[model samples]
Target: MQLKGIHHVSSLTADARRNVDFYTNVLGMRLVKKTVNQDDTSVYHLFYGDERGNPGTEVTFFEIPMAASNKRGTNSITKVSLRVPGDSALEYWKQRFEEHSVQHGDIQKQAGRLVLPFEDPEGHRMQFVSDEHDQGVEPGTPWEHSNASPANGATGLGPVRLTVKTAEPTAAVLKDIMGFSEIQSYPHPNDTDLPDIRVFETGKGGSGAEIHIETRSDLPAERQGRGAVHHVAFRVEDADELQQWIERIKNARLPNSGFVERYYFQSLYFREPNGILFELATDGPGFEGDEPFEHLGESLALPPFLEPSRSEIEARLKPID
Candidate 1:
């Protein structure tokens, strides 16, 4: 299977505006698109990433007002890392965190990259690292200096990194099925139980391996719950290869056997050994289906199946504003 890389990472949050504020304000990521969940219109489906909202850089969230406990174990989200410019940018982020009053762990290094770990408003473990990744999409830089008087600002989504249970079948899927070739490896640092951090890029050293996967800790496993990433999606070249990927998953003894087509592409969902859900998504019939890329997420989009309910669905949606 020749899968490209991540299409986007979807997770849960208690509120949309708070999540938006954290990404756009504190982190300096652009709200690429603002829209509502196709299925559950009541909740906003927010997209945050670089200028064009390219693959791998996009991290999505669902707003479920009822607060839930942050879950962390062997199968949950351990950490989410994004690659920024470098070590100097990290110092800027440190000052920014202090200014925003956002709590974060001390600066640290992992796999030869400088990382600054922090949590979102909802407790989602997220970090920004100073590693230069050339995402094919022209990356965006922050427009204004921070109010904290930092030398720099938090840049756009670097690379969305996820901690997996193990690097086995998931790693296999990445290399063999997904078409992500091994780039290199690095140690997880002294304090972490994580093993050597293996690197893989989407294609021909394609800019920031859209969906970069790494195991948080090799010691044991964890469980998924609130605040942890629910699933990550890898983009496929087209529908044919995507269909083939569905069979490949079953061949690997993965249990996802059905195809649920979203507006832009089709998807196959199955849980990896570590319990984090993995989504194989087709890259085409893109955001243009409802609106142009420049204007995407500006309004509600309906899947073909849900087109008939446009009025009723719009009516039922909660007032996110």
Candidate 2:
């Protein structure tokens, strides 16, 4: 069984409303789902994605006030890169970030593609990669209320970068279990002295299909905090395929979450030897399962099992604008 591409990248957020404002108003993604973390019903799980909440377009967050103050380091997802229409789109984003006073770096060439590095208010690293090769053709639908114009909106997610003490073990897991190919290598874009980063790809291999591993042998392990990524999920076809992955991981003696029904999708989680959390998720039974496409994220949603406690959960949660 092969993975399609990244399903979503889930990170930590301290404030639900601020997170909503930044992604929806600033970056121009739609709020696709308003739900709670299934495992811990106390925290809110917010999903941001393209118009229909497509798999590759999602970047979600778990709002946990207590764990909101963590640090970044090795053994973590250092950057969540998004694919924009072209160089002109990158220029548009550059102007937007400047106007909004968001922390960002000047446009530079990374792997022969234009990239603009930036961070969210909570310090989670993010970047926009230009689709210079015309690899991504998915038309991004800008949220009607967003500040960004529809013409220059972000298309979808691009190469995701993960930092680790070494890339061998993680690379092996990617190639063997995740159906990724060792594509090529490039010098660390930020630091010339560090080891060259190894790139991998899944599915048909373009744009959102890539994963870059930075072998930062010198840096210590990362600390989990507000800006830290909780896990990176890959897209599988459906529940049957997800079950196949569970069996594969079991046969390989890899530790994994057997089967988790998150209402929107079924998920199975596991960690590589280097400690980066990886999830195998199905693409069907999407965000529209509970709420209509036009009304998504407009109100809180609780899974069937949790519906009984909806009142209590609603009373406890702080309203997000």
Candidate 3:
């Protein structure tokens, strides 16, 4: 059983209302699911994606009110990349970011593709990469009601960049356990003298299915906070495939949370050698399972297990809109 690609990246947010505003109104992604973290039902778990909240398209957040700012350093999921239509779309977003007063840098090339780096108000690192040359896992359709034009809207997740004190251990885990292939490397953006960032790809290898690992010995381990990524999950076909992955992780002797029922999808979570949390998640029974397509993210959603406590849960969360 091979992994598909990125399923979702869950990050932290202190302000659920502002987070929803930025991702939906600014980035133009659809707020596909308004849910609570299953493990801790006290906070919001917001999911933004393309039209349908497909496997490779989601970017989620867990609300942690008044959390401190993230301490930037190594051993972290440093940067997240979102895929836009093409080169011209990068230009479109550049202008849009300016109009919205979003902090961003000039468009540049990364791994031979055009990318425009930016940050949310809370300082979460992110970039928009042009999918002009992508050939692998297909991207999701942009939301029809997005504030940004569909042609220029973000489509799906691209390569996630991880910064660590050393890359070999993490690289080994990715290659040996996750069935990823080391395709190529590119010079680190900040220093050519440092180790080159390595690119790894999985099923259908493309922007949507790759991981970029950067070695950063000079920095300390990250102190996670409101702006830090919680974990990155890769795509599994279904419960059957996820079960196989659970066995694989167990066979490898890695500690993991096996077979989590997330309602929208099933998952297994484990940390790699570098301490970066990784998850293998099933793709189906998606966001549409609970809410109607048109009214997604309009109300709070909890898994069947949590439904009994919906009123209590709802009372704790502040309205995001």
Winner by TM-score: 3
Ranking by TM-score: 3, 2, 1
Pairs that collide in candidate 1 are 3-178, 5-235, 56-210, 73-222, 74-221, 74-222, 75-222, 75-223
| TM-score against truth, every candidate | 0.79, 0.96, 0.99
Most lDDT-accurate candidate: 3
Write one digit per residue (lDDT tens) for candidate 1, span 1-321: 555555677888887767766776677665656666766776667777655465556778877667576556555545566656667777877887898888888898665556789887777877876654443433344433333222344343444555666667667766675567777776665444556666776753443444455665543554444576767777777778877877777887866846877766678898766556778777666556666756655566666677786788778666544
lDDT of each: 0.65, 0.86, 0.93
Cα lDDT tens digits, model 3, 189-247, are: 87899999999999999999999999989999999999999999999999998999999
TM-score of candidate 3 to 2 decimals: 0.99
RMSD of each: 4.0, 1.4, 0.7
Compose the digit string of candidate 2's lDDT tens values, residues 1-321.
888888889999988889999888888888889999888888899988878778888899999886647666799998998888788888889999999999999999887789999999999899999887845324345556656776677667888999999789999999987779997898887788989999899886776878899987777789899998899999899999999999998887788889998878999999998889999889888888789888999999888999999999988888886
lDDT for model 2 comes to: 0.86
Please report how far candidate 2 places residue 55 from its true position, in Å: 0.6
